[model samples]
Target: MTIGIEYLRVVRERFAVLKGQGDKTFAQLDEEHFHWTMNDESNSIAILIQHISGNMVSRWTDFLTADGEKPDRNRDGEFKMKRMSKAELLDCWEHGWRVFLNALESLNEHDLVKTVHIRGQAHSVIDAIERQMAHYAAHIGQIMFIGKQIKGEEWANLSIPKGGSDAYLQRMLKEK
Candidate 1:
């Protein structure tokens, strides 16, 4: 498989893990918790989701053909708390990922050489994908870290549980 395709797969899988981790983090929290900001400078989980969803919809729709910044995107509104329900939040998250995955599936090695514009700046398709991957991972890490802090001892580990990594590694090696 081409590196581009592999990167796509990896992003998709990472997205799934991040989504699940975020959801698990929120499962115990109330709507107030979702909207809580540490200060004026901090964005809540709701804001993050909205921003991510907006980016995904704009960047992925007609991905290779159109500029990554869609004319319809409201960049500022994303920071506002729009959806109050967890269901709505999850829906927005899924909507973005579905669009992103569809666009990734449409890509081919030759398409990597094609240039696309984001905020009027030109970038090759592969470069754009890599950039978004890093961006998403960074945000997701923040989300997970905050989730853990908010939940404290009650927070469920998203990956291997504390003290379970050795056993998990042993099991994986045994399977191999």
Candidate 2:
């Protein structure tokens, strides 16, 4: 594969891994846990979902042609506490990822060198993708942290569990 194609493929895989981690974290939490906050100032998983979804839609829709911070996006509103069912929250999450993934899928190797604007600032497509990847990964980390805090001892491991690294390594070797 060309470097650009390889890069796109790897970027999609990385994003899938991050999304999978978020999915595992969500699966471990109850509906009420989505709203749990460490303090009045901190955002809950619900807020994070709203913000991430809003961001994804804004940044990915018309990704190559328009500014990433869309004129219609209410970025601040995404942070406001809103009571939503687990299903609703998941729906929002799915929508965002769908838009993002679809946009990525639509890109060709030639698009990688093209310029895109985010908040009126110029960026190459590669830079734009990397920027959003970091953003989503950070939010997913927050979601996982909150889930782990709420579940405590009951939380299932998303990766190699504690004291299982050796076993995990052996298993990986066997697969190879």
- Total clashing residue pairs per candidate? 0, 0
Per-residue C-alpha lDDT of model 1 across residues 1-176, encoded as one tens digit per residue: 87867766776687677667767776766666677777889988888888887898999899877889999899999987675687788788889878987887777768888999898899988789888877777777777777776778987777899789999999999999
| Residue-by-residue lDDT tens digits, candidate 2, 128-160 | 999999999999999998999999999998988
lDDT of each: 0.80, 0.96
TM match of model 1 to true structure: 0.86
Best by TM-score: 2
